[model samples]
Target: MAKLDVELKVNGEDYKLQVGSQERLLDTIREQLKLTGTKEGCSVGECGACTVIVDDQAVNSCMVLTAQVDGSKIITVEGLESKSGLHPLQKAFIEKQAVQCGFCTPGMLMSALALLNTNPEPSKEEIKTALEGNLCRCTGYQQIIDAVEMAAEEWGG
Candidate 1:
């Protein structure tokens, strides 16, 4: 196997790395970039635990090859917050008590972020559709939905 040189912009930072052909974006983010905020629940794409934003769209990091996303801008859970303060989504998640166990929170947040980025005022059904891929065993999704709604009210900037 040969290593491919690639450049990726993640969390507003650009990185040039040598990646194997078989390396998944999830591995690149978690291992090479050390952004463990994107968890790997199932290597398969069924579990949204490895979700991240690639080129403004929410995608499963486990489903994409690192080489496939070369030169792409990606956003992980870490990217949602900044030095100024927590992103509105983060604040809403905490305020609404949307996190439990936290295994699925990162993916859920990423999905919600993608949706809100495109549609600041998404309907409840829209929120559900955006989060359809992410599975959460806790919270029953009501709090998460509420959190997204709350973030929409606070954000939209």
Candidate 2:
């Protein structure tokens, strides 16, 4: 396969990489850019474990080809923290014990981040809808929803 030249802005950093045309976005982010924060659950896109924010929308990385997202801005779980402190959602997740096994965390965080970015004060139903694509075998969704609610409060949503 021929390698294609591409540039992606991820987590506020720009990267120029040579990617194959058949490369999935998940593999490109994880293997090429070394953003291991994006997990790979079901490559078929049913699990939502490879979720990332592309231009403020939560999308399954496995569902997109790296070539399809040229020049796009992406945000993975690694981007959630800053020098000041952990993001409000991260704090809430830790306090509420919403993470388990840790495989689903990155995707969950990305989905939640997208939700908050769009609707800071999302109702329970909205939260549920936002995370419907993400599957977490551990940590029942109640705690996750609670954590999102708490973050909304902290972020003044």
Candidate 3:
């Protein structure tokens, strides 16, 4: 297989490398960049555990080929935090106790981030819509919803 050269800006860092045709963006982010916060749940894209922000939109990393997003900007769960402190959403999640089992939190966060980025003040229904793709077996979704609301209120865009 021929390795295709790709460029990506991830979490404020730039990267240029050669990727195999079969390499998915999820593997490139995890294995090549060593950002493991993006989890692989269902490879078929049913589970949103591998969600990430590609060019400011939330997408299932498992479904995207590395070569498909060669020049895109990507943000994973690890990109949410900074040297100052946790992102408002992360703080809200902790305060609302939205994390349970911790399997889907990364995807949930990415989805929520994308929503918040576009809609600073999203209605509960909108929040639900944004998160519908992400499946969380724990927390009953109420806490997660509450966390998103809280983050929106606190961040105020």
Candidate 4:
């Protein structure tokens, strides 16, 4: 297989990488970029544990080929924080105690961020729709929903 050179802007940083045709975006984000926040639960797209924001849309990183995203902008769970402090969603997640086993938090955050980026004032149903692909075995999703609501209240302005 020939390695294709691709450029990606991830977490506000630019990276030029040579990726294999078979490499998934999740593997590139995790192995090449060294951003471990994006977790791979199921190699298939059933579990949203591998979700990430690509070009401001929530997508299953495992389902996308790295070469398919050349020149794309991506935001992972690592991208949620800043030098000043945690992103509003991150703080809300912590405050709401929406995390357990910690495997699904990153994908959930990215999905919520995608929704919030477009619709800052998403209703409960909207939030649920954005996160329907993600599956969390703990917290029963109420806290996660609450976290997004809390963040919307803060960051929605």
lDDT for each candidate structure:
0.93, 0.92, 0.95, 0.94
Cα error of candidate 1 at position 32, Å: 0.5
Q: Which of 1 and 3 is ahead in lDDT?
A: 3
Error of 2 at 24 (Å): 0.7
User: Can you tell me which runs of candidate 1 are displaced by over 4 Å?
Assistant: none
Candidate 2 TM-score to native? 0.97
Full ranking by TM-score: 3, 4, 2, 1
lDDT of 2 by residue, 1-157 (tens): 5799989999999999899988999999898888898999988988889999999999999999988999999999999999998999999999999987889988988999999999988999999999999999885788889999999989955
lDDT of 1 at 69: 95
List where candidate 4 sits over 4 angstroms from the true fold. none
What are the runs in model 3 whose C-alpha is more than 4 Å off?
A: none
Model 1 earns a TM-score of 0.96
Q: Please give, for residues 50-147, the per-residue lDDT of candidate 1 as tens digits.
A: 99999999999999999999999999999988889999999999999999899999999999999999999998899999999998877559999999
Q: Clashing pairs in model 3?
A: none
Per lDDT, the best of the predicted structures is: 3
Could you tell which candidate, 1 or 2, scores higher by lDDT? 1
Could you tell which candidate, 3 or 4, scores higher by lDDT? 3
Tens digits of per-residue lDDT for model 3, 1-157: 5799999999999999889999999999999999999999989898899999999999999999999999999999999999989999999999999998999999999999999999999999999999999999775599999999999999965
Which candidate, 2 or 3, has the higher lDDT? 3
**What is candidate 2's CA lDDT for residue 27?**
93
RMSD of 2: 1.0
Candidate number with the higher lDDT (2 or 4): 4
In the range 1-157, model 4's lDDT, one tens digit per residue, is: 5699999999889999999989999999999988999999988998799999999999999999999999999999998889999999999999998987889999999999999999989999999999999999875699999999999999995
